[model samples]
Target: MTTPPRPWPGLFISFEGIDGSGKSTQARQLYESLRSGGHDPLLTREPGGSPGAEEIRALVLQGDPDRWSAETELLLFTAARRDHMERAILPALQAGRTVICDRFADSTRMYQGRGGLRDKVDALHDLMIGIDPDLTLLIDMPAEAGLARAKSRATDEERFEDFGLDLQQRMRDGFLALAAAAPARFRVIDGNRDMDSVARDVHATVLRELAPSS
Candidate 1:
C-alpha cells in the first residue's frame, strides 16, 4: 500500500456520495452533533470551500456544459482544492479542530475519472494533495433515487446533475468500487432510509471510528 500523508492533530472526516444521497445533510448533522458535544468542528464543502475555490467553482459549475473539456475541468478542480487545503483545511487541522467536508478528491476520481482520467486524477492527488480523510462516509443508494432527490433541489449548480441518470448510475458504481478498494478508510452507509435513521447510523459510525484506541 502507498504511504499515507503526514498526520495532523485534528480529525478529518469527509462525506461522499452520488448527488442527493444526503451525504451533505449527514455531514452537516455530524458537524452539529460534534459541536453540540463540545467539539470544535468545521463544516465545509468542496469546489468552493475557500474564497479562491469559490471563484473556481463558478467557472466549473456554471456556463455552457461544453465550456471546458474534461481535462480542463480536472485542472480547475485541482487548483481549487489546493487553495482549499492550504487556506482552510490545513489551518483548521493544525489548530486541533475537526474538519467535516462534503466532498473531497474522491469526487474528482469518480466524476472526471470516467473519461479514462482515473490515473491522472490519482497522480495529481498524490503529487498536489497527499492527505486523505481519516474517515470517509459514503452514503450509498440507487442512482435513480439519488437523481430524483437531486432534481428536487433545483440549485443553480446543475452541471453534474445535468449529466442525467445514466451517468449517475456509472458514478454510483465507481464510488462503490472506490470504497471496496479502501475499506479501512471508508464506511458505506445505506442512504435509502429515513433521514433520522440515516443520521443515527452516521452518528454511530463516526463515534465508533473516533473512539479511543485501547
Candidate 2:
C-alpha cells in the first residue's frame, strides 16, 4: 500500500490514461471551466511542470526510445517529480489553490512497470513522493483508438507513444487495474465519447470533489 501525504487544505487532481486517451485535453478543459466559474486553479503537467522538471522532461522524452534503461529512466523521472513537487505543486497547495496535473506517478507505474520494473517504481514512489492526488480521472479507451489519435498529433514527445499498440494495450489494462485497486480516488471515465461529453463528466467529477460536504 502507498502511504498518503500529510493533509493539505487545497485540492489536487490528476489525470491518467494510456498515451492519447485525451486525458490531457480533459485536464485542460477542467482548468478552463474552473477558471470561468471563478475558481483559482493551477494547471500543470508531469515531468515538466517546474523549470528544473521541464529540463528533465526533454531528457526523458527526447533521444532514442531505448536511450535509458528502465531503472535509469525511473530515477530521472523521480528526480523530476521531486523538483516539481517542491517548486510547483507543494507551494500551490499551501496557498489553497486547486492543482490539476495532467499526469502523475501513475504514469511512471504504468510505463516503467511495463519494462519489468514495477516493484522498483512503487518503492521509489513510496520513499520519495508519497503524495497521491485527491482525485485521479482515468480516461478509459481502446488502445488502438488512442494510438491513432496520438500518432495524428505527431509531436516530438513521441518516446512513449512510439511504443506501439501492444504496449499501449498493456498500459490501458494496467491503468484499469490501478483504478480497481484504489476505487475511492480513481474515477474511470469513458474516453471513447465525444469531447464535449467527456469534458462534461470530467467537469462533474471535479465539481463534486470541490463541493462542501453536507
Candidate 3:
C-alpha cells in the first residue's frame, strides 16, 4: 500500500522592516516566548547567519560608499543568504525547529531592488521565492519616524542607511505592496505604536498561524 504524506513539522517565520521599525526587538521576544513554551526556535538574522555570512554582514553594514555599490550590496546579501540557508536555516527546519529570521530576502527587495536599484529587484525577489518563508511578519512604520528613532540610537549611519528620505519612503511603499500581494504569507503589523503593543500584535499573529505546541 502507498504511504500517506507526512505532516510538515517545522515552520519558517521571517521578520522584516526598515531600520528602527522594531523588528529585531519583537523577533527576540517571540523567540524567547516560543522557547519558553517548549518549542525549538532558532533566532537568526540575515546578512549574518553563518560564520561566512557574518563576515559579509560586517562588510555590508560597515562600509562607506567608496567600498560599496548597489550591485555589490545585493550580491553580497545573496551570498550570505545562500550560505546561511545551507548551513543554518534549512537544517533547522528539517530538524523540526521554527526558524525565525530577523530579516530575509524581503530586505534586499526593499533596500536594493526598490529603494536603490529598481531594475534588478524583480529578479532578486524571484531568487528568494524559490525558498520562501512559511510566514512573514512585516513590521510597518513611517520612514521619517523610523529614521528619527534610528538617529537617536546612533550618531553615525551605514552606507545603506545614508540613503535619502525619499528612498526610504519608496522602501516602505515596496514593503506595503508586498504584504498586500501576499496576504496568506505576510502579516503587516502596525509598528507606529509602542514596542510592547507591536510585540503583542506580532505574538498574536504567530499564535494564530503556528498555534504553538503546548
Candidate 4:
C-alpha cells in the first residue's frame, strides 16, 4: 500500500508519439533546458519511472509480442502507473516541480487500445489512475519514415516495433486523431525535420504553455 499523493500545483507535461517519433529526445531536451534555466523539473517515463514501475517495464517491454494478453498488459500498465504516480510523479508535482514524462496514459490508450480494449483502458485509467497530463506534445511524422527509424534502433525493447509497418501506421493515425480531439491540451509538432529543429519547436511550445504559470 502507498500513501495518497497531495494535489499537484505544478505542471504535468507528457510527450506522446509512435515509436521513433523523437518524443523521447524532445522530452529530455525540455527537461534539460528547463533545468538550465533555473526551473524545478522532474523528468520521468511511463511503464518505468519509480523503482517498482521500472521493474514492470522490463516485463512488458522485453518480452514476446504475445507474451501478455492485451487485458493482462492493461492491468500491468495500470498497476505500474499507479505505483509511479504515488512514488515519483505526484511527489515532485506536490513540490511545485514541472513533471515531464516521456509517456503517460495516452500511450496506454493508443497502444493497448489499438485492439478492442479501448473502453477497458479508459475505464481502468479513470478508476485506478484518474489524472491526465496538463499538456501533451505529440511528435508527428510519416509512418514509413518513423518505422524505418524505429527499426534502425538496436534495442531489445522492440516488441511494439516488431508489429510491423501496418501497426505503426495505425498508431500514428490514432495519435493524430487524439490530438485533434483535444486541441487545447495537445500540441502537434512536425518531426520530419532535423533533431535540432524539432527540439526548438518543442522548447518554444512548452515555453508558451508554461508562461501562464511562470
Model 2 over residues 168-211: C-alpha lDDT tens digits? Answer: 99999999999999999999999999999999999999999887
Candidate 1: TM-score? 0.95
> What's the TM for model 2?
0.96
- List ranges where model 2 is wrong by over 4 Å: 1-6
RMSD of each: 2.5, 2.9, 4.0, 4.8
By lDDT, the better pick of 2 and 3 is: 2
- Give the alpha-carbon lDDT of every model: 0.91, 0.92, 0.81, 0.91
| Per-model TM-score versus the true fold | 0.95, 0.96, 0.88, 0.94
Query: Relative to the unseen true structure, what is the C-alpha lDDT of residue 42 in candidate 3, on a scale of 0 to 100?
Result: 94
Clashing pairs in 4: none
lDDT of 4 by residue, 27-142 (tens): 99999999998998999999899999999999999878899999989999999999999999988888899999999999999999877999999999999999898889999999
Candidate 3 lDDT over 1-214, as tens digits, reads: 3332223467889999888788989999999888888888999998888999998888888756457767877888888888898899888988888889999987887776743475576576566535778899999899998777766676444665676577668778889998988887899999999888988888888887675433
lDDT of 3 at 203: 82
Could you tell me the lDDT of residue 190 within candidate 2?
100
Candidate 4 clashes: the total is 0
Question: Where is model 4 poorest over a 10-residue stretch in terms of lDDT?
Answer: 1-10
Off by over 4 Å in 4: 1-7
Q: What's the lDDT for candidate 3?
A: 0.81
Q: With candidate 4 superimposed using the best TM-score fit, by how many Å does residue 196's alpha carbon deviate from the native?
A: 0.9
The true-versus-predicted C-alpha distance at residue 102 of model 4, in Å, is 0.5
